[model samples]
Target: SSEVQMPMQSGRDYSLGEYFVEVKVGTPGQPFWLVADTGSEFTWFNCHHHKARNKTRTRHGHGHGHAHGHSHGHSNPCEGVFCPHKSLSFETVTCGSKKCRVDLSELFSLSFCPKPSDPCLYDISYADGSSAKGFFGTDTITVDPQNRKHGALTNLTIGCSKSMQNGVNFNQDTGGILGLGYGKDSFVDKAGRQYGAKFSYCLVDHLSHRDISSYLTLGPHHPAKLLGEIKRTELILFPPFYGVNVVGISIGGQMLKIPHHVWDFTAQGGTIIDSGTTLTGLRLQAYEPVLEALTKPLTKVVRVPGDDFGTLDFCFKSEGFDESVVPRFAFHFTGGARFEPPVKSYIIDVAPQVKCIGIMPIAGNSGASVIGNIMQQNHLWEFDFSQNHVAFAPSTCT
Candidate 1:
């Protein structure tokens, strides 16, 4: 079985809303910071206009490592480093290819293709009205091994994005997004095929200083085994997303009386584990009960007067407010998996001297609930795809 270990650094963006990871691509390995998104399936990066001359060099065991030699250094403020076309092993998929005709159409629109022999181009539109247009290609992606020896995953499918529209800006030190979703083309699925379908990650606190770091390990070298008393839950198989049966949520040991349909997977209403989302999102059916249970107890404390900030609903004044008043939340999943997130995970600091309940309510009744990255902070999450199970354990994540 293929096994690889890579260190993961987690930090808040300028808006303090998203988490991203640094990835090295191309031959000489140009490092690019990308959003680690479990909700998406396509890995893409911004491209530049300037081209570079290829010069072969050896770094890791792979001899294909080559650095780009260029003098007319025109830089892009958004992309930073352009795709080293000449130095990297790259190929564009044709529009008539099996991958483009079948798998690509599931996540992206293929209407832009002018000819069947042309490159398989795609346009991915997000719920936030942001979009990315690009063509599919395969290349090498290098990951810095913990032991200092260079490691790489070769011939990986990636998106060579040509343009971004609307809110899809790469200004926050982010080159693109690393898709870890369950789709066939996603990084997790592609790597899982060789790595025995197992992967794990330890997430640090969202509010933690930038100096702190974490780990995202693939295959058998999981870190959760060292943490002790692992709680296992069945990983509900939902294509293109990691779904789990979140039976109910309990606050301070009291189980909230939520409707059964709120947790029904057959109804297209269930919980998924997503790293891209910053806050937990529960369907309106479930969110109301959870919000009532959490807010009813906090009435004695001073409430901050503010309108809904972005997706957040419950905001409170942080001045002289004791966080101990907030209760611990435990998520009960199928197969006896119980996740008890620390108080800081749910009640989060959004601004200076202001904290808010980090859970958001999905407007519609048919949408799936999301267990966002914020709720998984300071914990080890192990995805055992081969065994169809996911294990979790509390951890410092450093």
Candidate 2:
């Protein structure tokens, strides 16, 4: 694939869309705009559309992400594929005002619409198999005035989902997601075509605690050196969906054999390399060996949380470090190429005096394990479906 030119400025650093900071939402009395999510393109948020709502101050109550006077077991807003004007996550639908409207990508053009009677409902699906219903409309957006990275507005589109994911871990205050992906239909790419290209980002380590400046690098503004120089790693681009490949795994310089499985590629589909995702999920066949590698150190000291997938370390609450051992993961791509994560890449936090078990535990998993951006941060990854391969060139993300 031909290299893309991405422009950059001196002291002022930014790619295309927003990053780091988030905006808060709600009415004047209420604070916050919304946290923008490039991982998601369409924008939507909890609304005030409930008939039982304080119809006086709050306008539309019975909304998307927020449920007022609702029950979980009784009603599910996302019951059907298409929601015209009826859906509630945990609320008893006393009123009829839940519908999806408009395409988020067309939001900017959607404003000052030469037409009025057009429908604005849209259905959005996430990588986790969750869906939401919302409308696309132009609304005023404001970033923190003090923060330069948050203040500058380049190419962005916001959408509000009257409804959103029920049981998930994301900034719920979001009106909706700000998607910056490969599809030409996304708002960021659509609006900033001249400056945008396939999306790219680099995640800082959890330990670095460094400013996680993962910007969406787009357009012809990148450094010429990045384009002129060439470093290519052999990659066999699988189908776009949840395409997970456990080509090979290694621990402490020892190789472990495992089965390979792919993830969903298409929309609401399979797994691919997602820079935005935080954890790297692998299938059971791949999970077992990796988990065993993780458990080897602290079987007696660290309490193992047992489940179908067995003991996996996803803890906000931990007793203490069982052992202070540095681990590694090496992935063998197609051909003779191999990727060995540096100690800093897998370690929990790299700052002085902080040590962590770089591996997580899982009993078994069917969902695709993600090689998230954190894993790819040091490498300049190039995904070219057109060429049937994705290449990675090592870099510090300068």
Candidate 3:
């Protein structure tokens, strides 16, 4: 059964942006327009030939209208310092075959061949059902070598989708995503073999706004800082596509008794741990406690307009107020991995005048929260399918 993305399209809990995600199959010495999304996995890029329909780049019936019903426009390549062109760029494809050698005309990389007959294309699916089709090649991608506990990435697939669905509200400079899934099919798995089955990142904490942060570990570089022992619960772990079971949940140190079936990853729209969404979304029942608890701390604030969903907004104007005096959010996985996000990360403001209820209230209505990057800004996360558990290391987003 297809998982239900009730209320929202993604219905994710937390989201992270500026993620040190890497796409391995990228063209050497190349920079692409990519949006750091936590709502979905499978990082991709724009390919050379794409079929544009309705003045938009969509056809597979997997993206935009069919899957999530959201329209996405073409992405603009980032030309400023913010783009990671030089860092993750490479000289050519490591394919080693003359057949896969250079096509000077194709812009993404120097390894493109002018005339090719290979179906060297990738079909990338988004939570919204819109898909991107592109060519898949190999390249080395890197990140965060500035600090001691650094993060470096290599050998991942990045599709070059010619067209994409609209999600412009979120900075989408690239026409693709830096996928973060599991197993040999994933870039980390491919490059890890040569680079020592490992990668690391200093996850930033959006809450503290601290300089020091957590780490995203792969292989031996996982589960650091005595993150406590495993508390195994029931979680749905899908090796085929890469999805997880919710297992259970906790709030401010209290574990709520929800059905094991509801959290099943197999259940259509059951639950997904996305780092791209800005809020933690749950089904009608799932979102109640989180929303209720969060409301207690708002001593006095501003109320504002909202979308179709009863989206709430609040803000305060105090000289010295404590933002940390509230209930905590802890998502207890079957393996005892308590995915806890800072309240400040959830109690976020979308605009200068509005304070959006971070744990976005959806699912109950007709939308899913595509886990934005806001929730993930401060934690170290690892997609460990080999072990059947994604790892986490706490850190501050610098």
Tens digits of per-residue lDDT for model 1, 140-162: 77765333546667777888777
The local distance difference test score of model 3 is 0.45
For each candidate in turn, the TM-score is: 0.87, 0.54, 0.60
CA RMSD per model (angstroms)? 5.2, 11.3, 12.1
Worst 10 residues of 3 by lDDT: 2-11
Task: Put down candidate 2 lDDT per residue, 197-308, tens digits, no spaces.
Answer: 4434333333333243333343323231232243333333332221333357788778787644432332222235654444455655665677677557544453333232
Query: What's the number of clashes in each of the models?
Result: 0, 76, 88
For model 3, residues 226-302, the per-residue Cα lDDT tens digits are 33332333323442233455556676777776655556544444565565444556666666766676667765544
Q: Identify the superior model by TM-score, candidate 2 or candidate 3.
A: 3
Query: What does the lDDT read for residue 146 in candidate 3?
Result: 32
Query: What lDDT does each candidate get?
Result: 0.74, 0.41, 0.45
Give the Å shift of residue 75 in candidate 3. 17
Model 1, which residues run further than 4 Å from truth? 13-16, 49-79, 145-149, 166-172, 224-228, 306-308
By lDDT, who's the top model here? 1
Clashing pairs in 1: none
Which parts of model 3 are misplaced by more than 4 Å? 1-28, 31-41, 47-125, 128-157, 168-172, 195-201, 206-219, 222-236, 239-247, 253-259, 266-270, 297-299, 308-325, 335-337, 362-372
| Model 3 per-residue lDDT at 303 | 47
